[model samples]
Target: MTTKENNYTSLEVGTFESLLSRNYKGIEGKFFIGNELGLSGCEVSLNRLPAGKAVPFVHAHKKNEELYIITGGNGTFFVDGVEFNVQEGSLVRVAPAGARAYKAGDKDLYFICIQAQAGSLTQATHEDGIILNTKASWMNGKK
Candidate 1:
């Protein structure tokens, strides 16, 4: 059986790259959607970073699992206290509550980042910083 295609096309990430002057500028991330035909359960995005640039801060997620699939350029990813060299064709996954950070190497870097939502709200703080969300009303407002 053949079914008619949807009236709208799936989001294309790479196509939007040209619309911006700097691939990674002004925002926390630079991204475009590729094909979200079968996307489910998790959030996916295409991220690009210029040479010598860092994405976000050095923090970890308390209840979110994330994976980075390197599509181009070199990316250095710090996972769980170790630094892993990421490049084209590299797939890195950071489990929930694990430490993770990434930076572009000497060249521009592009990759697809997949983040699976946690069952409940997640709180994350830097490795050396104080607990940003220590107080929780659900937990009797304890830190």
Candidate 2:
């Protein structure tokens, strides 16, 4: 099920355990949620690469930078001419012109990629957020 409230959208694609259990675009274990959630700021994708598998091509973004969050397993990341080891808890950021590629290690590699235009963030949490003078539905009277 999915929902789109006035100011927010909510949906559940699947659980973490079932992330790689479904087929996406003739391949198992890949999903993109930005479009489905009506996102305007970024494109987000969840991917699972099997052991010893790679992207098969090196590429660079024209204007968008990419942020990769390694969620599980290990992998090798190549950027420009540099290669490095990435494992769980690793977070990588590639600029718009950084040619990059990835290969899974000896086990399945799971990651999420968030893509957004470089230099597009003019305001951050402290500068763009507002504190409403209200309480949560469940915190109506609680301190």
Candidate 3:
């Protein structure tokens, strides 16, 4: 007995790109955006941090969980007030409403970020000059 296989051809690929606005807290970079497959509560984006720059000051969220997977270069990862050295193939995860921040170490940094929660992700400045997480809902209508 022989089994039959189904063949599929490529038509088009789905891609999402969002331009960073001047009013945004972060610097300029291509944001490869996308929604989770078959799920409405999660989203993902790839961020490129240029040399001598930081992704976000230091922040926490209310209902969203974020993970950063470093794909190139080196960087300093700060989580919950603690610092960690991260490089290629590093994975850092921040829980809902957890404080975190990171900076590229002497070189450009490329990483994949995933966010899953009930609202949008945002950043705010704290009294001590530290960055804090506001709410993810702020991005609801802006997109």
lDDT of 1: 0.68
Give the clashing residue pairs of candidate 2, or none.
none
Candidate ranking under lDDT, highest first, comes to 2, 1, 3
Q: Candidate 2 residues 1-143, lDDT tens each? A: 79999999998987645777766666577788888899999999888888788887799999999999999999999999899999999999999999999999998889999999999999999998999988788778765
Each model's C-alpha lDDT?
0.68, 0.89, 0.66
lDDT per residue (tens digit) for residues 1-143 in model 1 = 22226554444334424433434446444653323444445667767677798857677776678888888889799877898798999988788878788898997777788787765335444544665657567788555
- Give the number of the best model, judged by lDDT: 2
Best by TM-score: 2
lDDT of 3 at 137: 75
Candidate 1 minimal-lDDT segment of 10 residues: 13-22
TM-score to true structure, per model:
0.61, 0.88, 0.59
Model 3 spans with C-alpha error above 4 angstroms: 1-26, 30-32, 35-39, 118-143
